[model samples]
Target: MAQLEQFTTPLDAVVSRMRALGAALPERDGVAVFNRVYLAVTEEVGRQLDAGRFPDPGAAITLDVRFAERYLSAVDAAAGGSRPPACWRPLFQFRRHPGVRPLQFALAGINAHIGHDLALAVVDACRSLGCEPAELEDEFDRVGDLLTTLEERIREDLMPGPDLLQIADPITHLLGAWSLERARDATWAAARALWALRRLPELAEEFTERLDAAVGLAGRMMLTPLPG
Candidate 1:
């Protein structure tokens, strides 16, 4: 417990610094932050790879899907007739950090496994709505599929041989492949949903339900918090 606490202070400080840095970050800087976060998360996941101590990536993806739904409800309430905010551009901007390319190898692999699981959750969520979830489902589903593709495309590089991560992440290669506009639309939809939920409690019930589910999943993932 004492040792765990030691890591907390440093990580919190790093995250605080990252946020402070974020204030001055240009569009590219946001991508840098994402890359850094991805690296850190990937490293942590890699450590867990040996023992599989981490929660399933698919589960994490599912949690995010629920977050999106909650955000949608909230956004709808917040804006009313006003146009929804643009969130996808910022997110895409965040996804392609330059200096942080070192972590791409790990992200591609871990994200691949989780991406499919997350996509399934999205499809299920859409089905529950009684109408086709064209925008939301398509947008998020693309990310999962892309991650899966990234996994396969980069598998060899990530494995033994030479390291390709230092040069560029597979995602970076997709640049010029996609117009920033596509991501911008999705980002706006997601942000609007989040902003809306914060302002409207009644409509934000989904957020609470999903949060509860996340906690429950955590508990279920491990019978207890202690190490095996």
Candidate 2:
């Protein structure tokens, strides 16, 4: 009970920071677009936690907080004029480009968070919980499931109207190639692989770096400019 109490403050702080970001950025700004989406999801997670939806509330909170911190840290880094992780560079770099649509911004942010930060966040949660990735599977699945639902809503809310969009739209093809479900699956694999290589610090570092770079490349592709 006391351990769980320890996480509550941090979780509240994270959500508060996200809310502030959502309030501060321009609604149409790429990072703000993603921030609004993420903020809604975070608030939902908080509600679920309050409703006792997670079997392991402590583990769930720990995972959720750690996962969010990674994204927030990247935001902080960029704000501080320091380099964020490679996976986050594209969205930050292209955030204000006139040609990138709101949908691209949202998905690119998701790609960086889920594809790169998530695997690392899982490991962070494990270390904090004194458990392995397997133990966190239930929490991970619940969060991932929530995100899958978010993905659907993002598409519904941000995507162009059907009348205005068609099979040949470049944005359609660009966003079509990336899937939140696939990213979740890969992140799980990466988390397990990272856990396995925990003893080999050098190798683990290299693996993480490569994963960061690969996810960043994908994010860059997703952010490819298109005519508005």
Candidate 3:
């Protein structure tokens, strides 16, 4: 209980920062679209933490904070005129383009965060807690479950209606190409691989780089501009 309380301040700080971004960005901006979705999800995670929903609160907090910090760091880098990782560049670069749909923005952000940042975050939590990926599996599953639910909600809320959607729509094809469940599964596998390769710094570095580039490619595809 005491340890859990210790995490409240930092967790609250992350939530506050996300809320500020949600409010500050324009509604139609791609970053803003995704920020709103992410902010709501963060708030829910915080609430779950307060309600004692996670089996291991400390692990959960560490994973949540580490996950959020990656997104925040990218935001800071863009604000400071520095380059964010390739996985994140597409979303930030195309954030304000009128041709991109809100659903694309939301999913692109999710792809960058989950497909890239999440695997890294699992490794981060493992290092922070001085444990292995196995030790954090419960926390990882819980967080992934939350994101899965949120991803469904985001699609429902942002996707065009059946009347607006078409079989030949580019967005439809893009949507068909990605799956949040698959991403979550892959991230778990990546985390386990990273933990196993912890002693092989060079190999692990190469694996991480490849993972980043592959995820960035998927994000770039997700951000493909439509014929609005």
Candidate 4:
């Protein structure tokens, strides 16, 4: 019982912050669009935690909270006029562009989060919990499954109606080129590589920077504006 209470504070704090962001941002703002999607996922995570669904509740809480803080930190950086991480730059830059669809915003955010942040979050959780990445595999898989399900719903809900989805629609091809499953797989690999390289600070830093830039590039491509 005490352990559950211990896990609740951090999760509740993050959930509260997400809810505040959802209420504060404009409905159609790209960041807001992503924020709504993330808020839903975060709330669901809390529910799962409360229901005692995770095998290691402490590990789950650490990973989930650490994962969310990275995104929120980027938001704070941008809001404070500091440069956000490379992986997050495109979404912040294109957040209000009329040409970018809501679906694009949502996917771009997911791409950045999964591709860059998830890897680091794994490391963060491992360090905080004094465990190896392998120990967190179940937590990672469960979270990935949750995100995968949400990705499908995001596509279904934000995708244009049949009348609007013409063969010539660039978004159709643009979105098709990226796969959340592939991204998750790559992130897992990256996390393991990072854990291996942790002893080599310079190499780890370089690898992290390169990963951030690569993910940011994909995010930039995902946000490619289409003709309205």
User: In lDDT terms, which candidate is top?
Assistant: 4
Residue-level lDDT of model 2, residues 35-130, one tens digit each, is: 988888888888998998999989988998999999999999999999999999999999999999999999999999999998999999999989
Q: What TM-score goes with each of the models?
A: 0.23, 0.94, 0.93, 0.95
Residue 107, model 4, lDDT: 98
Give residue 85's error in model 1 in angstroms. 19
Task: Give lDDT tens digits, candidate 1, residues 1-228.
Answer: 555324232224433443444455453432343334333433333343335543443333333444334323323543365432222122232243343332232332232223222333344444444333343444344444444444444444433335655235333443213322333344334434544465586765565345334423322221111111
Q: Scored by CA lDDT, what does every candidate get?
A: 0.36, 0.91, 0.88, 0.93
> How many backbone collisions does model 4 have?
0
Which clashing pairs does model 2 show? none
Clash total of candidate 3: 0
Model 2 ranges off by over 4 Å: 1-8
Each candidate's number of clashing pairs is: 12, 0, 0, 0
Write the candidate numbers in order of decreasing lDDT: 4, 2, 3, 1
Candidate 3 segments whose C-alpha is farther than 4 A from its true place? 1-7, 163-168
Clashes of 2: 0
